[model samples]
Target: MGDLYSELLVKRERTAKDSLVKYGLIVLTALAVFAGLFITPLLLIAAIILGIACYFVIPKTDVEYEYLFINGDFDIDMVMAKTKRKRVKSFKLSDADLAAPLNSHRMDYYNGNQKMKVLDFSSGNPEHKRYGVITRLDGDTCKIILEPDEKLAQAMKNSAPSKVFLD
Candidate 1:
């Protein structure tokens, strides 16, 4: 049989908290610029520093996650500002203890465990349904949150029958 390959791209919705932080930084940068103009030369230097930092940081505020499931291996790539792309994480389906809808009871056990590190790669919108994969990462058990389409979910289920849930 051909190897299973499924891909899903999920755009992370910006939370109000993220918006606040991003906007706050912008406002602070503006204030620094204004202070620099009227006050001291040092303030202008500070403003320049802030401006440069903002140039690099602002684009990072918008993010997207791409999930690739190929032959039992799952990979998540982070896309920043629709330009930069970096691999976030990758794991084998066999490593998962269980895969279920984020809201499903099957996830409760992992969710309650403080030691279970959570790696969220899903869309931030509450209205969207996300999935969680309980797997080991760096030898510690972690819950990988993602938004996988039906095809990707099915491929994952097929790879690990005992571990994946359709939901």
Candidate 2:
């Protein structure tokens, strides 16, 4: 059979909390600049530096996550705003101990466990087709949540029918 391949691109969404934090930073920076005008020239310089720093830090990230599924192997990568891609995780379908919907009872144990490394690439909303993949690393279980396409899900199920669960 030919090699099966699929890719899923997930973009990060900004939430109400994120918007609040961003605006809070902006307001704080404006206040600093306003107050610095009366304090000293050095204070004004410091405010400008702080404003520049906030410009880079406060805004929501434009990072995109790419999920690559080739045959039985899976890889996750981060495509940054600078057009640079970095590998985030790599594993084979056979390596997964369990795969289930994020809201399923099968993930109860791993959900509350702090030792599980959670990698989330979902849309941050409940309606998405969110799934969790549980794997073992260094004797600890890790859970990764991602919104995968239907083709990718089917490919995973075909590759490891016993390990990957959709219901």
Q: After superposition, how far is residue 146 of candidate 1 from its true place, in Å?
A: 0.8
lDDT scores for all predictions? Answer: 0.87, 0.81
Residues 3-111, model 2: lDDT tens digits: 7888988876767876777777788777778878877666677678878877775643556789999988999987766467789888887988988899889888878
User: Which 10 successive residues of model 1 have the least lDDT summed?
Assistant: 38-47
List, residue by residue over 61-153, the lDDT tens digit for candidate 1.
899999989989998999999999999899998978889998998888777888678998988776787888898999998888888888998
Model 1 C-alpha RMSD to native:
1.4
Give per-residue lDDT, candidate 2, residue 120. Answer: 84
Q: Quote the positional error of residue 125 for candidate 2 in Å.
A: 0.6
Give candidate 2 regions above 4 Å deviation. Answer: 80-85, 112-114
Clashing pairs in 1: none
| TM agreement with the true structure for every prediction | 0.93, 0.80
